[model samples]
Each structure stands twice: as C-alpha cells, then as structure tokens.
Target: MVLKNLIRIRRSAARAEAEHPALAAAGLLPGLEALPNAILVLARERLAIAFANPAAEAMLGMSLRQLCQLGWTDLFPNADAPAGAIAALREEASGTTQLDAVLELPQREPLRVHAIIGSLDAAPGYVLLELVENEQKLRTDREERILDLSAVNKQLIRNLAHEIKNPLGGIRGAAQLLELELGANGGLREYTQVIIKESDRLQTLVDRLLEPHRHPHIARDLNIHEVCERVRAVMLAEFPRGLTIHRDFDVSVPDLRGDMEQLIQAVLNIARNAAQALRQPIAEGTACIEFRTRVARRVTIAKRPCKLALDLRIIDNGPGIPEEIRDRIFFPLVSGREDGSGLGLTLAQNFVQQHEGMIECESRPGHTEFRILLPLQC
Candidate 1:
C-alpha cells in the first residue's frame, strides 16, 4: 500500500512538474516553513524529500540536508493506514487526507501522529505531508491533573501543618515547665524530657510539610547538567562503594531559567530515594543510576504549547516501585519503604511544578525511569 501510494505521489509530482516547472522546482510553499507541524515536500521523480521545514528537522532530529537524502521508505519504515488514505485522495476529488500513523525517527522513541497529506495549489508537483504528534493532548491532560493535585496538596499541607503546629508548641512549652518544676534530677524529669523531645520532632515534621509554601521562588539562569552533577556528587559521596552513577548529557542544550537551589534539592531528593531503594543491588555491586539530558522540541506542558523544552531523565537499575504505592508515589506520606519519610517525591514534584515543569515516572523490575520536562520556550 505504501509503495503504491508513493508511486501515485511520484506520478502527480511528474504531472505538476510538466505543468509548472518553475513552481515545482521551488519545492515548498512560502508560509509552510513557519508551521508548527512537521512538513515535508516530495520531489517530482523518486519520492525523495525535496524540502523540509524547521519543525520537520526538529521532529526527525536531522538537518534539512540530511532529510533530503532519505527516501519515503526511510522516513516511514513501519507506516500504515496513511498510505492508503493518500492513495484514496489521489483516486477521488478530495484535496487532503488524514490518518493515524507511527513515525520512527532516528534514535528516538516511536511517535504516534495524526498525519495530514495534501497537495499544494501553487506547487502541484509536490506532495505536502504534515505530522502532528498525538501525545500533545495526552501530555496536556496529564499536566493539568498534576497541577490540580498539587494545588490540593498545598492547601491540605498548610491547614494540617498549622493545626499540628499550635498544639506542638503548647505541648513542648508545658513539658519544659514541668521539667523545671521537677528539679533536673527529679524522678519524673526524664519523662518530661521525652515529651519535649517528641514534640520537637513533630515540630520538625510540620515545618517540612509546610516548607514549599514558606519559601519564595528565586529564578536564575543555570545549566541543568550542573544540577545533575551536584546530585551525582552527593549520591556518590554517600554511597561510595557499590553504586555507579553515569552521565549522558547533551551539552548543547541551552541554560534554563529556574530556581537553582530548588531544582538541585528536587533532583537530589529523587536520586537519594533511588539510592536507598538499591540496597539489594548495591550489596551485589550491580546497582547503577544514569542521568541523561536532551532537548525536546514542539512539546506541550500544562496545556500550553512550547517550541522547545528540556528533557531530563534519571534512570536506575533496581527493584521497581511496588505496584500498591506506585500510583500514590507523589502523595505526601506515601512510601514503599518502611523507613522512608514519604515526602521526598512530594517535595520534588512541588519544586518542579514551581518552575512550570512536570515529572513523570515509568518502572518495571530492574528498570525504573523518572522524566522531568521543563519548557524553554512557550
């Protein structure tokens, strides 16, 4: 089906070239270069790419020169449905055709897209193919949910913290007063000391729960790899022997504007959590964590369109998150480990959201990944 469609496109291109030689040679329409969807034009003879817009280059992770070198088969290796739709358009009077298709770009995950194929009136010899990623809607919806959940968590934490704080202060003061009443060496002084100590511990917990609200966001231009390195150093220092930390950074990614300390703390919290989960692997000397950074183009975040974004991933080789708590990992007080404070991931999510970013996780036995997406241009 794809081959027959390619033949039809080639024949149409040949006819257009015969009718308007000059326009066919120009390859692309004037305004198509500025489009957000990945657009490509096929040549009159062999269905080779004659023109590719900037968005196409970004989507395919190639230069215009590189794309021109590929044939239709190279671009759509496992394509389906769209080819038949295009063939139908050629046979019928339809000016355009649309279908869902999978696009396999170089060294990237397979992209699901809604492909729109049509002919240009001015350059009829050329076939115009536009690809709009299907994940945009899903990403936007997920981001909205994250924002809503974060808002609810913030309100609940503030109210609960305040309620806990008032009683905690009173309890600590009353214990102090009682301790003084019974002399330092009195029989019950130790009991009063225990009460004061426990109160102080609870106060600390409350303070942590309210920390995100108390702190002001301070934005600065900083390199993401620097944050990764800082966290990597800390994790290595703490682990020292068995765990291995690796880096796969794209140095060309531009510096992002965000709160440096908050971002650092956010990444550190996740790394520390991963390290803690690697106890069994560490003992066997097979534990590994990798920090990878890349530039994502044409992404949607929090229902907003962004031309460019940062994709940072922290991947670990360890036992996966338990299925029972996996869905609630970011909820405060939820933990898979017995000794875990359960606030690390919650604080991490809050910090990332403050920078207009979102974090997503995927896990299975022996492989777990946390992806952080932050928009560079919206």
Candidate 2:
C-alpha cells in the first residue's frame, strides 16, 4: 500500500508539470506574482510551479500561495505513472520540441494545445514550454468556406461573361452599320460611334473576366525564381529611377508546375500595385519593394492541402493600405487610389485561383506584405 501511494504521488507531480510547464520552470509557486497571461513554468526535477503568468492564475483558479502550498500529487489525484513520462521527455537531448496533450484546469474542462518544449539559453538547467492552441481544424474550416465561395464566384463570372459576349458583339455591329449609313458629320452618327466605342470598352472588360477560364492550362515544370526575376526586370525598366527592388528567395526550392506566363502576369499585377503605392516614397527616392519566397508545409488552399506550398511575399515600404479600404482591397472595383482601375487585384486573384492557390494581405503603417500561397507537386 505504501509503494502504491508513492507511485501515485510521483504520477501526480508529473501531471502537474505537464499541465503548467512554464510555472514549473519559473518556480513561481511560492509567491504568485501577477503576470500578463496564464503561463506556468516547471522545473525538471521537482515538477513544481516555478513561475505563473496571470493568465495561468485565471486558467488554474488558484492563488500563487495556494499553488505553491500544494504538492504535485495533491493537485493531480488521478495521474498515473506521470514520473515516467517526465523521465522519457528529459532523456531526449535539449532542443526545441513539441507534444500534443490534454491539460486539465481546476474546475474547468480539459483543453488541448501543442506544447513546445525547448532549453532556454538565458536560463541554465531549465526548459521553456510554450502552449500553442491547435488551430488547424479552424483553419481548415475557413479554407473550405473561402474555396467554396471562390469556386462559385468563378463559375458565375464565366457564365455571365459568356452570356454578355454575343449581345455585345451584336450591339457593336449595329452601331457600326448605323455609323456607315449616316456618313461623316451626322450628329446622330456620332451617337452610334459612341455606342460602338462603349460597347468595345465593355467587350474588353468581358474579355478580361473570361480570360482565366478561356486560357488553356499550360502547366510546365518551371523555376519560380526565374519568373520573379523576369518581373523585376520589367518593372525596373518601366519605373526606372527612384525605386529599389530587392529579391529574397529560397534557392533550395525545386521547380513547380504552373503556367509561366500567367504566373508572370499575376506577379506583375501585384508588383505594379506596389510600385504605384510607392509614388510618394519614390519621389523622395526611398521607396523599396522586396520579392521573398519560402517553403510552407501542410498549408490548406481551397480547403485541401496540396502537401507543399510556396510562400511568396511581396513587401513594400511605403504608406500602408488605407484603413478605410483595407478590408475591401480584394473586392472587385475597390481602389484606394483615385486613378486606379481597381481591376488589377481582381484579375490577379482570378489567375491565381485558376492555378489552385490563395492570396492573403497584411498591412500596417509604412509596411505591407502580400502573400501568395501556391502549391507545388513532386
């Protein structure tokens, strides 16, 4: 009976550390100093609260003194063989590590988190464990909703464009015929000419709307860096003086299969927008644009993981996106600049969606990052 009791005590201590590793590490159990968040640190040997964030107090429902007074065994009554788990984790070499587990709080339900464990260089004989809630499930749900809406939006745009095309041609033809009937200098003929011009303009818009669908998929193995380089050259030539363009790429990333021309256009559209945004900075000769790429794994695009994804970030150092129009920046016909057509991003998004990808934007004063997430296949 005594052996069983000792075993239970050890198990309880282990459970305590697992629940509040931060407190155990900081040794905050004895004096509950108010901290910002509910974070607890645990030490390797004793499994006692070393430090606790204010958030931890709310989460555990215990005062610092109360926590310090209780032994690990007293806190966790039903923990089984907890000491063994700690021993196993400690045996591994010191480095950043992660584990997914359930943590029970006082009078509260068990919560799940991906616990990150690593040795702290600043503190000797101690480890740091940070809890990050597993948000993959929620991300998956959001991706699904966005993708479903994008697919539906694409189909509607395509159908609408097709329906408008035939009528548009007829209208242009009728106007042309009317113009020919009232040869030169006829006031009424000018109206027909105007009709033809407006029809042509609408036709251009419709063509752009249908372009992504009409273009045949031309997937070929190509280097993304090459694409970015080509875009950089073109933009530099177009905007020659006063703007500095920087390239930051992950050279290790292998070639991906995609339409080279479409990718170029998509990138160009974004780059052009950045260049335009830098008008003020360019005048002062301090405007800059950066093209950066990295590898992202298990990224969900359109509700499914393509397994591997490329993170292409277009950064600009200029006045950030205006707060009034930031949220609607991706919507069609929304433009922050007075002279902007607002169709650039719309077209870019359409092209990217065709390539089975997604785009996200983040902006703050003097900084903006547009991230394009594209899938790569082996």
Candidate 3:
C-alpha cells in the first residue's frame, strides 16, 4: 500500500511538470516543436536564427541548418530585423513582447505572423520567438466566404440556367417555324437560322454552367502524371503549331484519391484557359506554357492542415489576366473575353472544391500562373 501511494504521487508530479510553462520558456520542452506556430531562438546581439522548430522551417521554406547559416533578414528573404526586436524586448525587464509582422519568403508569397518574442529566465541573450501565421486565423474566414459565395452562386446559376433552359426550346421551335414559313428563297430565313443557332449556343452555355454542380463526384485513385499527360496531349493537339508545353513533374508525389474525370476537366480547363490567352503569342511562335508539379509541405488547404499537398502550376508567358475581372475571376458569369461563356473557371473551381482543393491565380503583364493545390492525404 505504501509503494502504491508512492507511485500515485509520482504520476501526479509528472502531470504537474508536463503542465508547467517554464519548460517551454527554457527551450527544454520537446513538445514545442510539435506546435502549429513557428518558434525560433535568436541570439540577442546578432539577431540570427540560432534554433528553429519544424514549423519555423516549414514556414520560412528553409531547413534549420540553412536558417542558422544566415541572419534573420537573409533567412526570411524580405523580412527586417528579428533579433533586434528581441533585443528591444530585453530592455522591458519582462523580456517578452508581442507584435504583428509580415514576412516574405523565398518560395511563397508574403506571410503575416503574430510574433511573441521572449527570453528564457535561465538563458540570457537567448531569445525565444513564437510565431503564429495569420493564414491559419484567416483560413476559416476565407473558407466561409468561399463556401457562402459558392452556395449563392450555385443557387443563382441553377435559377438562371433553368430559366434560360425553359425558354431555349421554345425560342428554337419558333425560329424553326418562322424559317419554314419564310421558305428557302426568303432572305428572312437567314435571320431565323441565326436565331436557332444562337439559341443552341445559349443552351450549350447553360448546360456548362450547371454541369459541375450536377455531376456526382465519383472518387477514384488518380495518378497525377496521367492527368497531366492527358491534358498535355489535348493541348498539344489543339495548339500544335507555335505553343510549347513543358513538364516539370516530381515523380515522388503520391497518387491522390479524387474523381479522375472531374480532375481531368478541372486541370484541362485551366490549361485551355492559359492556352487561349496565348492565342496572339502562339501565332508569333513565342508562346510557352509549363506544367510544373511539386509537393507542398506543411500546408493548410481549405481550412484543413495537410502535411502534404500537390502543387500544380500552369504557367503561361501570355498577356496576364486583365485586372478588371481578376478579383472576380472565380465568380460565375464573369469573363475577360467577349466570346467566353465565363463558366469554365467557375466550373473548374467547383470541381476542385468537390475534391477538397482550390485554384489560386496570380497574374501580371506577360506572366500568368494558375496554381492548384490539392491535399494528397485525402
């Protein structure tokens, strides 16, 4: 009974120690590395990255070894002083401070992080910096907005398509009747033929607007390379003359579980969009498009933290997406080209969303890239 009591006391003590915050402050806790926020230890004088957690490494797109080789400025591509911030905190006696800052990395766009800079009570001149990316905080907001927009857009699309679908057949039949009444020799038949043909075109447009939402997502094991190859073949066949499609696929990326046909359509839509943008350049024999696939490490996609995701970029050297509709590119019925039905990207976004993925676009004059990120673990 005495031994049992002793064991029970030890277990209680263990739990107390585990709950202690001092271990984290002193850098003695292994659990610190497992947190979602990035942590870095910087020397007070040099403001250099002396130690980094796995999250920090992933956040900065640099290994700890690589980060330790350079000062904070050099490590975070386009960030200002990190250790200097910590040094300023040292003067406060508490040796801790919180600030919001933006950092630009080498491999990705800029990141806004909430930084907690502090020093261990036992370790002088050794600062512990805790960083939580705003991405995680903003993810839910972005996802909710996207979902709400998708729902509203879907309802609007269904209503509009159904509205157009009903009148389309009647319009075509009336045009046909008018054509028959006018007879073959009448010039007015040309006007009726135009009405029938345009009615068919409008019907086709309505069908495409409703297509992605209607189809049930048939999930299957999809080899990404096969999808890329299929898209490449289709694009090359269509724009065989002056366009070049380059492939930089990382074979290490594992197969993803998704609807093969839907995934194919999603990718093909983006690829074809890029190809179409290169219309003038393709004739100039200067058009180039690249299909680059790589693994995205430690990414949060669609509000879900994914240890790995597929990063597929369709890059084109054509004139960029026009600025007017760039923000509303994913919205239904928004189009840059006059002849464009504007449903291609909307359908593509819907298909990707069905697979728990997203399509992001970045464009400027002479360069346009549509990046698709899909979680591989799903």
Query: What TM-score, computed on C-alpha atoms, does each candidate reach?
Result: 0.68, 0.65, 0.67
Report the poorest 10 consecutive residues by lDDT, candidate 3.
12-21
- Candidates' C-alpha lDDT: 0.82, 0.73, 0.80
TM-score, structure 1 vs. true: 0.68
Question: Which tens-of-lDDT digit does each residue in 298-367 have in candidate 3?
Answer: 8877778888999999899999999989878889888888878788899999999988888878799898
Clashes of each: 0, 23, 0
| After superposition, candidate 3 runs with Cα above 4 Å error | 1-132, 136-140, 214-216
Q: Residue 65 of model 1: what lDDT?
A: 66
Q: Which candidate ranks first by lDDT, i.e. highest?
A: 1
Candidate achieving higher lDDT, 1 or 3:
1
Q: Model 1 — which ten-residue stretch has the worst lDDT?
A: 85-94
Task: Summarize candidate 1's per-residue lDDT along 1-378 as a digit string, tens digits.
Answer: 978944644554454445546655665444666577888876434657877766787788886667777886677777757655554555433388787777776678878888888866656555678988887665566678778888998999999999999988999999998888888577799899899999988888888888887889999899999999999999999999899999999999999999999999999988999999999999989999999999999887776788999999999998999999887899999999999889999999999988988898888899899999999998
Q: Which ten residues in a row have the lowest lDDT in candidate 2?
A: 28-37
* Winner of 1 and 2 under lDDT: 1
